[model samples]
Target: MKAVVYEGPNVLTYKDVADVSPKANEVKLKVRACGICGSDVHGYLGITGRRIPPVIMGHEFSGEIVELGEGVNNLKPGDRVAAYPLDFCGSCEMCAKGDVHLCLNKRAFGVLDVDGAFAEYICVPAKVCFKLKDSVSYKVGSIMEPLAVSYRAVSHAGNLTGKNVLVVGTGTIGLLALSCVKAQNPRRIFVSDLSDSRLEIAKKMGADTVINPSKENSLDVIMDNTNNKGVDAVIEAVGVSATVKQSIDSLAFGGTAVWIGISDKHIDLEMQKIVTRELNVKGTFLYGFEEFRTVVEMLNEGKLNIDPILSKEITLEELPETMAQMAAGAGDIIKVTVVNND
Candidate 1:
C-alpha cells in the first residue's frame, strides 16, 4: 500500500507502506475519497501542533467496506460510507453525556498518533461509519466532516431568522458556514476574505455582500451594508488574530460570534467590547454525534448545496504537491478532495 507520509515541516513523501487491517469491532475500508482540510494544511506547516507527524494525515474521508471485524452487525462489506473520525471511549463521562468529542480517551484520525485515510486503505471502528445514500458520490461523502463542522457552528449561532449575519473568511469551512447560515433565512449575509477569488465564490454561494479586506476595509464595508449597525451575528472561520478581532468588531451589541476555525492558537481580544456591549463569544469544537448525523442526512436529502466550495479533485499521488500549494497559499484553490482511483 502507498501513503503520503508527513516527514516534517513542509515535507510529505509518497511511498509504499505496510498495509492495515481491521481490529475486532472495526472495519477495513478501501478508501475512495479524502478531502484536504485546513487543519491538515496547518499540520503540514507545523503550525497547529495537533498533527505531530511522521504519520498519515487526513480525517475527512469516505470509502467502501472491504471487510468487517467480528461483532460488527450494523454494517457489512460493500457498504459505501463516511466515517466520524474521532475515536472516543463510549464509557467516559463526556461520552455518557453525548459529548463524544470531549471524551478523555478520544483519538482523532490523522492527528498526533493515529494514521489516517491518506492511503489506499484504512481501518475505523464500525460504530463511526455512516452509510451514504445512493445519490451521494464518494467525493460528496468525503466532505461530510467539514459540513458537520459548519453545521455545528451555525447551529450554535441560535436563530438567524430576519437578522443580518456575517461570516469572516471564505475558505472551504467559511464558504460552507455561509451555506449553513443561508439555510436559517437570515435577512442578509456578508462574507469577508483576503482573496477576491474566494469572495466571488461566496457571492455565488448566496452571500449578499462580499468584502475583500485586502482591497478595502472589511469593517467599513460591513458597517455600510448594515446601515451603520454591526451585524446581528458573526461566524468566524479564520481563527487568526486579525480575523478573530474582525469577527468581534463587526458584531452589533449583544450579537453572537461562533468561532470554528483553528488556524491560530492565541488571539488578543478587547475585553471591554465583550463586556460593555454584552457580546456572546462561543467556541464550538467538532460536532456531536447527533450533529454529524444531521449533516449526513442533510446531504443525503439534498438540503445543502456544497458544489461551489469544492475547488477540484485529485488523486492520492497528487497530495504531496497539492498540500504544499495549500500550505503556501499559492493557488486559487478552495476545497480539494483526493480521490482514490485504484
Candidate 2:
C-alpha cells in the first residue's frame, strides 16, 4: 500500500508501506476519500500532542470494505462505509454514560495509537463503522466526522430559530455550522472572518451578514447591527485565545456561545459574563457514534449540500505539498481532500 507517512514537522512522503488487515471485530476498508482536518495540520506541524511521528495521519474518511475479519457479522465485503475514528474502552464511566467522546482511555484512529486512513486502506472496529447510504458521495461520507462535530455544536448552542446568531470564523467547520444552524431559521445570521474569500463563501452558504474584522471593528459592528442587544447565540469556530475573547465580547446578554474549534492555547473565560449577564458558554467535542451516523443520513437525504466547501481535490501523492498549503492558512484553499483515483 502507498501511504502518506508523516516524518516530522513540515515533512511527509508518499511511500510504499505494508498492507493492513482487519482484526477479529474489525473490517479492512479500501479508502476512497479522506478530508484533511485541522487536527491533521496540527499533527503535521508537531503541535498536536496526540500525534506521534511515523504515523498515517487522517481521521475523516469514507471507503468500501475490501475485506472482513471474523465476528464481523453486520458488515461484509463491498459495503460502503464511514467510521467513527475513536476507539473506546467500552467499559469506562464515560462510555457507560453514552458519552464515548470523552472516554478517558480512548484511542483516536490516525492520531493517537493506531495508524490512520491517509492511505489506500484502513482497518476500523466493526462497531464504529457506519454504512454510508448509496445517495451520499464518498466526499460527503468522509466529512461525516466534522459534521458530527457541528451537530454537537448545534446541540449545545440551543435553538437558533427566530434568534440572532453569530458564527465567528469562516473555516470549513464554521461554514458547516452556518449551513446546519440555518436549518433552524435563525432570525439573522452573522459570520466574521479575516479572509474576504471565505466570508463571501459564508454569504453564499446563507449567512445574512458578513463582517471582515480587518476593515471595521467587529464588536462595534455587532453592537450596531443588533441594536446593542448582542446576538442570541454565538458559535466560536476559531479556537484561538483571541477568538475566544471575541466570541465572549460579541455575545448578547443571556446568550450562549458554543466553542467547537480545537485550540493550542489555554483560554481564560470572562467570569463576569456568567454572573452579571447570566451567559451560557460551552465546549463540545466529537459527537457520539449515533451522531456520526445521523450526519451521513442527512447528507444522503439531501438535507445538506456541501459540494462547494471542497476547495480542492488531488491525488494522494499531492498531499505532502497540500498539507504545507493548508498550514500556510487559507491561501487558495478552504478544505483540501485527498482521493484515491483508482
Candidate 2 runs further than 4 Å off: 219-228, 262-274, 330-332
How well does each candidate superpose onto the true structure, as a TM-score? 0.91, 0.91
TM-score of 2: 0.91
Q: What local lDDT does model 2 show for residue 11?
A: 90
Q: Write the per-residue lDDT of candidate 2 for residues 218-248, one digit (tens) a residue.
A: 8888888889988888999989887888888
Question: What tens-digit string does per-residue lDDT give for candidate 1 at 1-342?
Answer: 989999888999999999988899999999999999878988999887877778999999999999998889999889999999989999989999989989889999999969999999999999899999889889889988888888999988999999999999887788888988887789999998888888889988899998888889988988888888999999999899999999989999999999987877788888999999999999987778888889888888887778888789998889999999877784778889999866
Error of 2 at 230 (Å): 2.4
Please report, as a residue range, the 10-residue window in candidate 1 with the lowest summed lDDT.
326-335
